[model samples]
Target: MLRAIVKQGLRASSRLAVNRNPDTSSYVQQLEAEWETAKPFSELPGPTRWQIFRGFQKGGQYHQLGMDEVMRLYRKQFGDICLIPGLFGMPSTIFTFNEATFQRIYRTEGQWPVREGAEPVLHYRKNRKDEFFKDCVGLFSNGPQWGKLRSAVNPVLMQHRNVAIYLKPMQRVNRQFINRIRELRDKDSAEVPADFLSTVNHLTFESVATVALDEELGLLREVNQPPGARKLFKNIEVFMDSFFILGMKPSIYKYFPTPTYKRFSQASDEIFDTCSMYVNKAIERIERKTAQGSTKDEKSVLEQLLQIDRKFAIVLAMDMLMGGVDTTSTAIVGLLLSLAKNPEKQQILRKEILGKLPSTDRDFSLEDMKSLPYLRAFIKESMRVYPVIIGNVRSAGTDVVLYGYRVPKGTHLLMVNSFLLKDEHLFPRAEEFLPERWLRQKDGNEDSANVLINNSLNPFVYLPFGFGPRMCVGKRIVDLELELTVANLVRNFHIEYDYPTETTFKTTFLYKPNFPLKFKFTDVKY
Candidate 1:
């Protein structure tokens, strides 16, 4: 199909050229055909299609080979690029540790970078085509339709100015969350509950909801928390938890009513319905305001989206909610855990936070976030060590040479950034948590540390939010929430961990800490 498109395009171009030599035209056609059929997948070193089950250690399932282990083995066995035969129903996946190759693939990607669409999401939307998600298309979709949807929504969702609008509301949510944390912990005991992740999830949901729906859902409130909000949160967990089984593997669920599939379906339904309900209410609110002769240009993301396409707006809202709940909350957990384990770093961060903003009671404003550089550095360091998304997958948009091997067009390339970011060759004392590594000197000088980073380190290897045009859209929003939450916590109390934290990560869907994160928080003198 790609070949046909290229050939057709070449023929059309040839026709437009006047007085073209026949021989030159023939040569161009041959080159065009070659480019079209240039996929040389066999040249790449990768596991066979049937080796999915046996690729890893004995008794280890295909997807169960933790990303860390997978990267280590791949680097040891395969030099740069290695192919893993298509697992489940998906195509062969290419894992690369080569920074140059990663950059080449990203640079070659066209407007809509080819990638494997989320099979389970595609199936769900198709199944519910005539329902609430009839016009819903989001990040899960691929090709021209996905491109159109992304282009329409990116302006509204990806803008820094737009994302800044939610800061005050998010800070309000953070304050309520801090109060909730106070309720959950004791002054003497100072131990946070095991369900702290859930609390963070609520805070994230409330923040994203207020911005996305333009209505305060009051999810952080202890009493009278909306049932729909709880359902949405629970279902987001269900969807993410079930995604590994339903998303990575083939459609066994399509034939058999597996437990995972059922949960995925239920979660998808609840998410769509709940998001739709809020979207409709928001629309009604906008309508009421417009009816009262209000002429306001200020528009929430949802309102901006609705103006372009209503179904698209709802779908975007649903994606934002699910993404905010797990992905952002998981990072917050990792950041807090890291800070807890390193009291020295925590103290440094606290000093910066309190020194910049004396009052810890009020929420941080946009300007306040700018004043604390160490807080930003801390978050970056945490993400580098423990990224929420293990790898960013992109399909090769065109055939390219990777280490003298022919990488075919539309080939799935998994940039194993999580493992690469931790390579000792790239970062000195890679295992240690050093936010100062991200800090720069006040006077312009090529310090030893900065020199090493600039000369030796391939900056592309540390892509926590991905790269190029396809970068994560809500990155600014996540940064805002994380910085604010951490600033507030550090300002108010000192954080410490009770037990040694040996960071063991697992992947149910996304990479998250396998063990319970227990932190002891104590009030500090301000």
Candidate 2:
């Protein structure tokens, strides 16, 4: 049925193309002809609304395979593009794996791109009695509202110089994390427990808090942690879990407060209150410093953001804490696993680190980070192989053509490019862990010859951090965090995973490892 529909569309397009007029410019006429012949949105191929509803029901294909696998199955059946009829009050979505379509959609996304996924959070913020979010709906918001928040925070978070200020503080947090790992590992086996991901979460929270709140939460400490830190951590966890259900899956969270929605709301409230308290403390501290006439050259991310607007600072801090912790921790775990499974690649990365630092005690400077190409390449490769999110989503900001179909404005577009990361045609030997593939020949390194030289590689196919104006604001910070953590770990430990099977990941709110993280960390002797 899908093949027949596609053929009919192609035939129609061909017939329309032959009717071009000679009076108008060829370019204008061609575009008009293409637009007129494009397939109707209804004729785009995928399972029907009833089929989607039944498929998600008990013991159905969607239920058995899960959304990630179901997407792959659809790709196989319907080719590169499929229109998913929304179920249970959700908007209809178009899923495309075509690189050209991805590029076209992103390039045309106007001044303010609309990323439509966090409906539950938006609904919660809008309906709050206090109207705390009336002025700013935060990073999850759309159009001019989101644009305002993003514009205010971009200079503070996106600049390299601004982000570099957090390196020393985050390094302190990484040291504690390394120490905590040593304490948690078994004496005989040298392996951390199956629940080591929790520890990683703590490490990430501590690191983010250093930048977001300008205070050491000491979450990785064995003895004393700051008050409300652990609660904030737990709440963020619940928020992530519930966000997947209420925001991603079908639910009537807006009309009626379901059990999942209630839990999500509660978690969100705690997260806001705790972050607000810390932000207030930060504000008082800043005021006190100012009163005393203190001139500190290096200010925290929060301090810089607070200079703009107090409320914006608080909202941005909360969003960073909620978004940064789980996502970064998950990415860190994935990178560590990649290093563990491929010992040679780990050693190569370690050699690069040691060549620059010479000793484990040496502190990471911004200069040191700039010189380490292999370290950066390793990170890029890891993300390519194990992307945290399945792909990016953007609501069509304007009428656009996608794979010969006219997508109307406000239609949800799911760009499923994760599969493209592993396509052999795009990246030669896509299964192997080769960091050298990311190294450019312009760097004039010995590994330049080994760099996978594919001229046809589309940049749009490999967007781990997304694209356009809505690209991740914390990208600079997250990059530094991953670099610091991995550098410290590799400098001190010979990481290994002794388990027979490989670590696998599942897609929830993000792509997280589904298996136990029982990694063995042996000390590296100089």
Best by lDDT: 2
- TM-score winner: 2
Worst 10 residues of 1 by lDDT: 14-23
TM-score of each: 0.87, 0.92
lDDT of 1 by residue, 1-526 (tens): 3233334534443343233323355644654565555556676776565565565436644455665666667678777778877654666778887888777677666656766637777777877746655444577777766655666666677787886677777888888988888888866788877667677778888888887777778777879988888787788888877876676654467667688988998899888888889999988888999999784677777778788767777888887876676788778888988888789999989888878788875566677778898898899888887788867788987666665566767888877667677777787777888887787754564332463244467768888777755677788888888888898888877888777566556764477766655577788884
Error (Å) of candidate 1 at residue 110 is 1.3
* Model 2 per-residue lDDT tens digits across residues 195-241: 99989999889888998888888789888776698888889889989
Model 2 lDDT, residue 164, Cα = 68
Q: List where candidate 1 sits over 4 angstroms from the true fold.
A: 1-40, 54-65, 129-136, 254-257, 293-297, 443-454
